[model samples]
Target chain A: MIDHLPYGVFRTPGREPRCAARFGDHLIDLYAAESAGAVEAGGTLRARSLNDLMSAGPDVWSSVRRQLLNRPPLDHLVPLSEVELLLPFEVADYVDFYSSEHHAGNVGQIFRPGQPPLLPNWKQLPIGYHGRAGTVVVSGTPVVRPGGLLGAGVVGPSQRLDIEAEIGFVVGIDSTLGRPVPIEEFHRAVFGVVVVNDWSARDIQAFEYQPLGPFLGKSFATSVSAWVTPLEALASAWTPAPPQDPPVVPHLNDDPHHGLDLRLTVTWNGVEVSHPPFASMYWTPAQQLAHMTSNGATLRTGDLFASGTVSGPQRGEVGSFLELTWGGTEPVELGAESRTFLLDGDTVVISATAPGADGGTIRLGEVSGTVLPAVI
Target chain B: MIDHLPYGVFRTPGREPRCAARFGDHLIDLYAAESAGAVEAGGTLRARSLNDLMSAGPDVWSSVRRQLLNRPPLDHLVPLSEVELLLPFEVADYVDFYSSEHHAGNVGQIFRPGQPPLLPNWKQLPIGYHGRAGTVVVSGTPVVRPGGLLGAGVVGPSQRLDIEAEIGFVVGIDSTLGRPVPIEEFHRAVFGVVVVNDWSARDIQAFEYQPLGPFLGKSFATSVSAWVTPLEALASAWTPAPPQDPPVVPHLNDDPHHGLDLRLTVTWNGVEVSHPPFASMYWTPAQQLAHMTSNGATLRTGDLFASGTVSGPQRGEVGSFLELTWGGTEPVELGAESRTFLLDGDTVVISATAPGADGGTIRLGEVSGTVLPAVI
Candidate 1:
């Protein structure tokens, strides 16, 4: 786990899907990775990128992630200086889970007051909502806010567009149909983790989020750091979760040591606000994986399963401005900055890193994006 | 609309992702679907055929989908001969939704018994799960039945893969960030619809479905009709839904006529067992669109959002064999067929057609596949 390689795609500018990762200064060609037996068992990186081979499901992927993590510095392989990171592999589906109990209760109290725990099924299984994959973009990319009708009637235009900084897990080596991945086996199947900022628009959401939930407020554009930090590398940081208030349904839960020791924090314009730890969640990622598979749906590589807004109980600890502002009521004060939601000039940074035993953070970089005027 | 040109990416022999669909005669070269116009649209149809585009969403393609639908003659787009069909777009993300109240209530009653109705959220949004987009084979493709362990532990190896014939929608534009898609604008952003047979293995599901939903049992394989009918062509047949039981939330719903008027039905072997209609849905597609957007999630073209299994209350009128078998306690009776679930070598067909004034069906053709034994 010593070598630092940056994963990305290259296309001679405009060409078919080509896989490459960054070494100290150049792209570590995945095509060569396949050919050299350094990646896939069968040479030729054809299914698209490392992701295609990943969707073949865990065992195969685990082996690769493990091998790559322990490989020594390939001083002669390549350098990062010669590469340009294209928009990472197109994400087919994004399923973000509300596994953060701290967030659930914190958000619940604000909205339901007395009911700050969770739904009966919340602790029992991984409750997830499928999100837009189209908006997922590579880092260093600017976010363009979209303009949509606000309120029921089309009167004027959209005003509030905010940002949500969080972390996401990418699935590699997907499971075959009907074969539910055992919680323990789930670990072996993971490809990597990346920092994801689920940018939002609180104003558009306020008017329309009742009967359905969230629409137009989210789908416009999303940004993600391109590097995929394999789960194997983050393994040393694994931690168990605190006991839940009520026992989960027997079918959906597992052992307590299921939580990953990942540190997630959010910053708006470089100001730290939400610093909730991943262990604060009642449900674990394994449990979430188990719950998601309960319905016979297949999980694939390039599948973006996010840990929904990691908010805490504190006001500034809110995951998104919508929660911090309490549905546009409370204005969040940031040093000299004050706002109920995100202003166009604001930049949100979502960084996820696992603190190694040496006390150094193994950061997966960060996904930062600035809001531009709405694209009409 | 005019010339009916159905597209796909397929060869005459290979069955990997290159198999072709069968149209009137000569295969419409997938290479040809690579339009000069699509390149201008900032998208390409470089798929080996429609197989990749149909399944490889996120890069929703400009092949002949819109051109075929807008042509008018509806029949002149056929190539020479009567036995050739190329490939369809590779569909990357396959999502199936449970939009039917009748189906939900009926399925729920099995576990809850006298439960009054389905969940309130069901009526509000289009709840969905991600499916295996990688295995979306072209029409006339053979399907391998998945086998798995039963509940508790392994009783023995069993062959109980079942079939769930569903109607699915394809997205045209994809969103990022947590942007919510507006309900009223859902159609404009949709590419088309295809009849899908969401294959399932209930037996394996029972054993493996716990913390998570079904994984291996259902991830095996799926079948879809060869040709895709564009969304615009179906607009004329669109119809309003019946009165709501628990009125919908404002933002989540739309005009009464938003639901499509497709006459969807499923057949096992040669027997017509279900006679349900699309209008029987408790929630409209608009609500599903709105709910999906509520979380500020974006959608992309080639992204499939399916209406989960549709079923009515009657004994034999259920959409899926799962309900008819009642957790495998009852055997479903078809004309000459009596079955609990699917069997190896068994064939299942899902056919959908819009009802014309003369009552004939404006068909999107059917998706039929035969189950083969698992390789082991």
Candidate 2:
């Protein structure tokens, strides 16, 4: 797919409202196609903004997908340079999960030598936490550093600050309270994917984490990629996962054949890193979804979930700064760059793709950002 | 403590402004106490709504505690039966943690075999998620289940549900961003504690857990205790923690002098079932706090923390019904109440007390509420 396609609310600088997806140097004006009867299956795509298209559900997403796949190219698509990618959807809610076995195990080794890396329940479930979606900003939006009130007992109060690069997923439609969508069918609930940068502070978390978990240390700004890649386009690349060790409790385990094969990698300043396969995880996304929903809560579209620190065991494959730097004990060398943790002006880029054995590849495009100086 | 002090604001039949806390049988009227020099160290207690007192910080809370703890002979005390316990503060942030080791391990065992109960990162850092504080209501306030568009298929729908009883701690002071407050000294940022009822819908969580942790399922509305307990009262009961299995990394470990042993119990319809002690947690409150600040985020007062499921290995000690009933397969039988999970009209009460090896326990009182049926 050489087309530079991006989902966004498109309107020419001097024209009426329209929803369009860009295709390499060109725009596939969805509204124009719908009006011209070229996109008949999903008549609902004729809306002014993508909200209607997004809310119309996955069937709409699929029908639109089919039309895009078959119809001859339309001339209405403006040049990629002529249009702006108005973020396709508003973030309803955001939640993050710590699923990186490399991260979990390494940290585990530090505290308890030779012990199993993850908690038993982790394999059975998708361990996750809720996040602030209102603060979820599109990539390119500048974020101001957040400040905190500190006790000035001895040392002059200010402490350490940091940043993290992680992948986030978006939900398309949600389920209601009384019914649960089964695990085998969870992929239908997925809307697309985004890149997330969850910034943090080492100081505040230490003090407040005693009885509860993180509060102020994370409530600040979080950045996410604007485009969401639909689950359908990526469906053909499904792959089986590695056998789970010790086995997942029966109810929580996914069918052996089930799971996605999204190849992901991060580039620091331009140094390419591992695009480890999702199959490498000790746990699968299906297991995580089933376990998360066992309690019967509803999921909504435009919601974001992060695979917190998706690091693998290899030192270079670690997903986040905490795992990459080993709590800042070792400095990381990214090609021409060498640093302990995320430093000012550092830029991190992450992207995911399904690299087919036959060389056909479909991917969740790159999410990149540059860190600015910490706000005083 | 015998005073049936219910917190609320009221006036005799048709009188002017009035605010009071349930104390034994007498309502310690703030209006009355302020005029009597009971609420002040200098001259007199200032008569105002509970809102005013909370915003004033430690000084006001100190003076009030002094008067309440003075114990002026039970015979001379007034009964709280005639007064109301008004809500005293507003919550700015609601943060919940899954800190119960029993809960962590039990669930872990189900998913992972022979693995350590908690993850390595969990010990070195605090795991938490933030929630909207606007939905937080004081105890006795009925919580309304939220409504949303949900489904697995783009347009399909569901109504699965669940519930959780938890403990909430209230922050008293505020911390700014980029500053770290050591866990040992985090208490100064705390104002007091409260009980919490965090309702969940299992169905919704399943479909949407991957890209985000929690959204509509946890965000709808969360109930919390209204009375803010001062940290000073719980100070005497704060004790060291039970040792961790694998020692934590040096940077994360504390001197072993300070983890509080808060014995907690929860019941559905007044029968005790979930009985996990805070002592069983792998990470202490101090450690959780310190982890959050490691990134330089600030801590603040009035911020609330919810302990994620506090389940232990024992049958009756499982924190949530999802754990106790094994995702609702094993029906949990209370004294005469059989609850596979929480049902509409079922009331869950969570009570916590600090056990002193040498003195009486400091308590966080209780968070109680009945599960109302989902709005059709």
Candidate 3:
């Protein structure tokens, strides 16, 4: 059986938040176990949030996970359905990177038809931009469609609402303010991965994203999986990445095992439509972390950086509606439903699985959200 | 005389941080004063940071200022030179807005010639993007030049480092997740103002700021004035904003006094270079705040959003080196030293003054940074 003890924050009806570890379909209450002298990891498990455990560093992270795995099920064991999950960590800064070549090529072709597919700097560096950290929510939170200045000078509800399915990496260690974290040491700085649904308002983004980057269009709400799959648990999923086309700089170059071989799936209204393969991504997480710190930007414990839409080569591998529908030129048919973009009352879910040590699959959980009408 | 009590965090050699306020040229230790029963406004002043005071709302903010103003000289008063100033508040989210018409026009002209001076959506919304909050430092911090992928397929030290002098506003009260804060209620949400130095790597920005916005080019460092001048203290500085060509929506359109009439000045080393007038900005701070939450994005207590480079429609009113040197076509003569962009060991300072109650100028202090050589 796969031994993936992903971490999360959960709570009962009116109880304080507690650190939890998932085993099969049940959750181990770390707080109650620690108090009962059954586990002796640290007091960090007693914290109301996962950020404290994240700040305890990788050594503690490993010890805690191992201890949680070896312990027998006590009376503290709770069913997953009985608890409510919250966002795993407090985000210090949220950054989204455009790393998938297939997604970038499709976006570039749709936006600029006659010109080159990717921008000149796309291949040279890991292109990213900061996003609203406070707006990030846990899975199951209802997202209200944003209302802003759309095209045709209309100030009303977003006409082109969409979702971007991607993988998000969270930082568990802080880096020095003026030093760069090399690609090899990315694991020391990063903690784990989660599924992220980067909600977007295409019309608002198109009209306002000129000189600056996307703001309100993507800031209203961004949903992330409540569970954080620790890096150590996913060791078996390590695989060789594709070779760099032009050869990246020395700082971005790393060992081939730095790449992850996860399979990501996006479902709309409970129907699977996209199966973007994480193995097809050109840039690895190690390279993304190295490029992020290359300019001496300090990394805090709760910082999050997401891999941009993970689209593969096939038609059903597109991650976002903009690419899946080819800029609304085509409509994606989901059995009895046909959609160009998302509509009110529509639900989107994203999940992923990685190779397990026993030749099985380690589920990374899912981040799901339903779109509500704009509160205008 | 104008008695402005700006708040900051400070500490002696071997002591914990304490809250303090500046009056004239001396800083009063509010923590010590509160302990000594010298001033009685609220318990928020006893904290180590200004965040607690900011969350205390406008009434508490006014009372604390008034109490500090009327108090007699305390024995805990320290000279400004002897105190170590830290960042006034913990930044939850940092956003920089392009609100100045002249700066936007000059940048547009230099970047895209034979096109309109401003983008089509310029006047429609306050264009802004999230920035790295973890890299934001206090005034006296030394900023290191960043190394990254530049043009010509070269990845090395940045050749064109620059600064954008701007005014920054800090949010005190939080807005609901899916609710918009009306323009008239902006004061209830915003706490204070401070001077900000948005450092830039022009070459890096030019190369990577395409499909996404600025990343490594601007994430290395951002410096801010240590002391935060409360908005209630600058009551008399309110002035009428420029009329909109096509009137804005009801949510953004507000009373005339929503404008701030501050005069911003920039200096290189010790020589005067530019003076950017805040009165000429097209959008007001209230309107910016309203637009930011228009899409139902939540606001946290320590959120900071800065006014973009405050350039006016004149030669000497440019705020950034890019415009002052006309995209490096012209060189700025700082007395005996001539430069196109910021050089290593060069110090840039930005300070401002606003209209006081007694018809005199009230000092807003300064935000200064010395550029260190690239650590490549």
Candidate 4:
């Protein structure tokens, strides 16, 4: 897709939803290519989300990516199997984080076996929480299977049912409440990248994650990626992250190329399983937006955040099914049966890619789902 | 004032913010009392926030509270010092909870000193999380003093800055994402009450709350309360709650009159100190909205939640200065100025009240703020 044009919110049969972009499988219609002038952007592409062209910030997002690569609207295409998409922005505060030190040492050695797998402020920073931006959603929706309690006075539904994978970002411009969005203003305060999922419920997050964290075992839904992708289509997907031996705090210092190298994969039910690299993420999406606004926390324009699972230290690189089934006491297999968590119809699907500025690759927008059985 | 009419979002002078209502000191302008036909609500109070009159729910919130107690628009008054208010709704996902068993046994005995101060799922349920809905704000706003990493390779500011006097609620009907909102549908899904604060930091939430919980030690600034109040102005403030020794389960049981009573009053700068009560809350805002939608999480219309630190077992009934300075090893005087946290231009406020089917009280709108220092 000519280095992934991304952006989303579609529609078709009886119009309305607007935005668009994509390209190869066709979609364009950025308000019908700016009403046929073939794209200029001032009228924020007749919005229906993408937070009005991501709050029209990074110089009108690089002048609408150089007028959609110099006018390639082809009379506002459409096809992508007759539209639909949606949820392409309107999250406004989600957070997530846990920046994967091998998925926090495989969820702290499968939930603290002998304690100390990572938590000492996990190499000093990016820990993060706050989710449930009204149960996120859009990316083949479905999901369900939640129900809670699960321990002393146990409740039901959710017999495990996991899947994390993450990545998210989004949050275009808007800051100051007591400012703090620094680390070189993360591409002038981010504006793209998606593929999330995050659904969990591991026994209602192991009996309600102690001391206040994962609520309702991960607020019931999550999913995401109905396109987006933008950070100028991953400018050759940065890279460097994975180092910080003991260095983090100067307001979460940064720039070791500020990682991105994507790669992910996941897929269950269709089998592929895990690949999860994102350049082995050890805290980077500009140090989780400079430690989520260091403490003056105020970002807004459809806020989001994510990047919490994306594992990577080998053995098929884990991005969760409780570290690819180890916490389900190891399961895996799949193609001919054999799983662990997540079952009622199970689908999954994550996806990713990156390295693009022409040397080809670029994908991102995937995030499927499926489950659907609880509502009990 | 005739049972606190509440609802806010003002403006005036050059005008724009819209929606209003208060009354005692004046400010009716609900779209100029729906253009002088003096209130019907179909156009949802000429909007500017209270989320289209809280998604026009609860039977148009009891037919606009019986057409504003039989049309008392008084020609859309206005005075409340010529308007301004703002931030009345548009939050959509905040949460918070930890249903005060004396503020989670005084924050689990000042952060687990010898462990177990209550946390066996804190007597079974109602603990919560998800905050930072774009740093909440709007009750006098200021706040600041945030800064982070306060430990290992330490960062600065926030020596202990705290506060938390709780009780929020809001939401307003919108649920079904795999259902669950049970506990007798908490008045058809809430729709009122405010007065929060919730700002904290305690050395950046004790060196970044161990394993994922309080981010940026309570996402810099959470104020709330430019009014709202109306759960039919707490019809004689409910009462019963505080008993569950160990029952709770069945979708969080519910209805020991479902608490409320209210009271509150913290203050600080003009020193009152603490009162806290809220009928000694022990989980009940209909069991924290049935344990926050018992995992089927959905509810939208500006979703809020809150009710965490409403401590109360004795002495000054704490709602945090980390348990009236117990964590900073006791201080609290204020007039002869002793204190123990939150300094820079200090301020605070909080306020509350309740019991009023007519027999007096009502209130709830307070929530002030101030603090402001660290942008470092």
User: Individual DockQ of the candidates?
Assistant: 0.15, 0.09, 0.77, 0.29
Docking class of 2: incorrect
Candidate-wise lDDT, in order: 0.60, 0.58, 0.88, 0.83
Instruction: TM-score each candidate.
Output: 0.69, 0.56, 0.98, 0.36
lDDT by residue (B1-376, candidate 3, tens digit) is 3367788899878888889888666788888888888877567878878999898888888778777777744677888788788888999999999999999999999998998989888987888999999999999899999999887358898999999999999999887887877788888889999999999999999998987888899999999999899898788899888888777877788886357889999999898899999989898999989989999999999999999889999979999999999999999888887889988999999999998777777889699999988888
Candidates sorted on DockQ, descending: 3, 4, 1, 2
Error of 1 at A223 (Å): 2.7
lDDT tens string, model 1, A11-112?
Answer: 554556566655544565676666666666444255355566556555655565556556622432545454555566557567666666666665566666
- Indicate the residue-level lDDT of A155 in model 3: 90
lDDT of 2: 0.58
Ordering by lDDT: 3, 4, 1, 2
DockQ score for candidate 1: 0.15
lDDT digits (tens) for residues B74-188 of candidate 1: 2223343433444255564565677777677766776558775565445434545555565566556666554344543233335666777677776666555434567787766
Q: Which candidate's DockQ is highest?
A: 3
Model 2 segments beyond 4 Å from truth? A2-6, A9-18, A35-51, A110-116, A145-165, A202-207, A334-337, A356-358, B1-128, B131-345, B348-369, B372-376
Candidate 3 residue-wise lDDT, A1-376, digit = tens = 2288888899999899998877677888988877887777668878887898899998998887777667654667899999999888999999998999999999999999999999888888889999999999999999998998996357999999999989999999888887888888887888899999999999999988887888898999989999999999898998887777787877888876357898999999888989999888888889999999999889999999999889999879989999999999999887798888999999999999999887888999799999989899
Candidate 4 local lDDT, A23-116, one digit each (tens): 8877788887787777888888887887977887999988888778866777878789987898988888888888888888878888888977
The CA lDDT at B30 in model 4 is 84
For model 4, fnat equals 0.82
